[model samples]
Target: MTRVDLNADMGESFGPWPMGDDASLLKTVTSANIACGGHAGDADTMARTMAMAQGNNVGIGAHPGFMDLAGFGRNRMSVPRGTLQNQIRYQVAASVGMARAVGAKVRHLKLHGALSNMASEDAALARDCYEAALSVDPDLIVMILAETAQQEAVRELGCRWASEIFADRAYNDDATLVDRSKPGAVIHDPDLAGKRMVEMVKAGAIITESGKQIPAAIDTICLHGDTPTAVQIATHVRRALEAAGITVQTFDGR
Candidate 1:
């Protein structure tokens, strides 16, 4: 049986500023990449989100990004390599300690926003960010964007990792994500998103917008929780995968 994990970003809500319907999203996703205060989320949100994930038996992950709360970490920034590494270490440590306090454990580490995009294209940067996280938890599972430099970093490091494809985002012919500013870059139609995921998972590759199939490992599918139709897309993707006889569960890394 073909199996894949469904993951969603959560815990982005700051104090008095709630973001993403985590409760509803948790019902459909098997794994959660929770924001660890670098881009979004706070100590309170982390504890609350971790508690919710533990109650639902969902796998928890530390989501660290560039410290740009004003930009939600989506805006790309140039930071020193050592600073970026320390940022990752700091965020992962916070996630690990908080999860322990809530009686939950963070099983994985996923880079967020611009940091993820940058790492997808730069192997050295990907290694630096992931290395910092691994320093905190040597057994941590690193989630990499499939068919990208992030994957290259993981392969070279010989660490446990999972390859991920996005359900709501379009792919370039080179397998990098289409820029968000482009038309049709972000798929909003739930049906289309669901159909695309089913196709990629069954083929064990990333089906680019140009109809090119880049052969890669498809261990998990991500549904961005900040989008308006994120929850709907996630629900449809789950149903579509199950309908096509694909098993959705937590990933054990590749």
Candidate 2:
């Protein structure tokens, strides 16, 4: 691919508690996957983030997770199927409505935290979430973790979708992200993160830790905005992609 999208999980700051330097990160990313008051954001945070994303001309997306703010949505939960679907719908609706109110529009949908990890492995979970979001907006692009059950769910649904790899997370042989608690799972070095992303994008595949290249439709690279060096990684990744003659821009979901 000659081009790819740079996206970040954003709008995570809670009331009276700020997180991440979103203002600086926004200057580098092409798309913003905003939290929808589920895992890490509130109404005011969503409005503020969407307006800033619009001002930056970045694409906006709904980022919903298990409504476990105490766990930051990283700790998994076991809820009934129908209730989980409704939770996703509720979060997505809030995001879409808030964006419209701010004169911005959500173009895509991405799951967050443990919800995303589970969906990456379970097609049923991923489809349920995607279907719930689609029920609200048919045109919303379902962003999937490439080479996983998430992608399988998208293909089965026959919906507009984009496939993404991570800029800072290590991958396993099966294309799953290394557990966050594991050592070296999350790359904190800006230069190393940039190098890994460029290599994966150029190869048109996810290069696993075992040196396996799983050919896939790589569309975007995700940067974790809550990390300490999020802006640095974003900036360097964009620069690295450009230096390698790969255009860093928004993804037009297929």
Candidate 3:
């Protein structure tokens, strides 16, 4: 049977302000890429989310991004490679510490928001970020955007890694995600998202907006947890994959 991991970006709430229905999402996703202090989470939020993930038997991952609380880490910034690497290391270490406190180990590291977007195109940046995370935990699974510079960097590093595709985002022919400002860029329909995922998994490639098929490693499917219908979309995708004989489970980062 074909196996795939279902993951979601989570734990973005900061202080009294809450974001996403992480509790509901935990029930659907096999792995949770939780926000570290850099992007949107605090120590308290990380601890709470880690405990919830542990109780749900979900794999834990650190979601580190640029230190931009006001923009939610979506705004791009040009920082030095060294600075980026150190920032990533600091965030991953903080996440590791929080997970340790809750008896949960962080199994992977995924770049978030603008950091992720930037690395998908720049191999040097991707290398710096992954190297930083691996420095903290050599065995850490780096969740990378499939077929991009991010994947190229991991292949060069030969580190434990998993290639990912978005369940709700359209892709360009080049495999970079379509600009969110464009129409049909961000999928909100559960049925559409679920069907696209099934097709991509079965084909072992990403089907772009122009019907271009880019062959790549498909290790995990990322579902957005910050949306209103995120839980429903996740549930629908899981069910669809299962119905098609695809096993939804946590990735071992082979």
Candidate 4:
């Protein structure tokens, strides 16, 4: 049976302001890329998320981004490579500490938001961030955007990693995700997103918005849990993949 992992970003809630429906989304996703302090989570939030993930038997991963809580880490910022490395290290370490406190261990590391976008295009930046994570835990599986510089960096580093595709986002011809501001960039329909994921997994490639095929290692599919309908989309995608004879499970970092 062909197997794939279903993952979602979680623990973005900061202080009194809440974000996604993490409890509901947790049941749908096999892996949770939890936001560390850098992006949107605080120490308490991270502890709560880690505990929830542990109770749900979901794989835990550190989601580190630029220190831009103001923009939710979506706004791009140019920082020195050394600084970026240190920031990632700090965030991952914080996550590790939190997870340990809850008797859970972080199994992977994924770049969040604009940091991810930048790393997807710049191999040097990808290397710096990934290297930082590896320094913290050599066995950490780096979840990277498939067919981009993020993947290239993992290949160069020869570390255990997983390649991912967005379930609700459109991809450009060059394999970068389309800007979210553009029309049709974010697919809100559950059925459409689910079907698209099935096709991409079956083909083992990314089907771009312009109908271009880019062969990639599709080990995991990312579903965003930040929207009102996100859980619905995640449920549909899981069902669609299973209906297509694909087993949804956590990736083994192959």
Best prediction by lDDT: 1
Candidate 1: segments with Cα more than 4 A from true spot: none
Tell me the whole-model lDDT of each prediction, alpha carbons only: 0.96, 0.95, 0.94, 0.93
Per-candidate clashes come to 0, 0, 0, 0
Instruction: Give lDDT tens digits, candidate 2, residues 108-204.
Output: 9999999999999999999999999999999999999999999999999999999999999999999999999999899999999989888888789
Worst 10 residues of 1 by lDDT: 201-210
Pairs that collide, model 1: none
Residues 50-101, model 1: lDDT tens digits: 9999999999999999999999999999999999899999999999999999
Q: Candidate 3, residues 149-246: lDDT per residue as tens digits?
A: 99999999999899999999999998999987899988999999999999999999999999999998899999999888899999999999999999
Error of 4 at 239 (Å): 0.8
Error of 2 at 144 (Å): 0.2
Kindly report which residue pairs in candidate 3 clash with one another.
Answer: none
Residue-level lDDT for 249 in candidate 3: 94
* Model 3 TM-score on a 0 to 1 scale: 0.99
All models, RMSD in angstroms: 0.6, 0.7, 0.7, 0.8
Task: Give each model a TM-score.
Answer: 0.99, 0.99, 0.99, 0.98
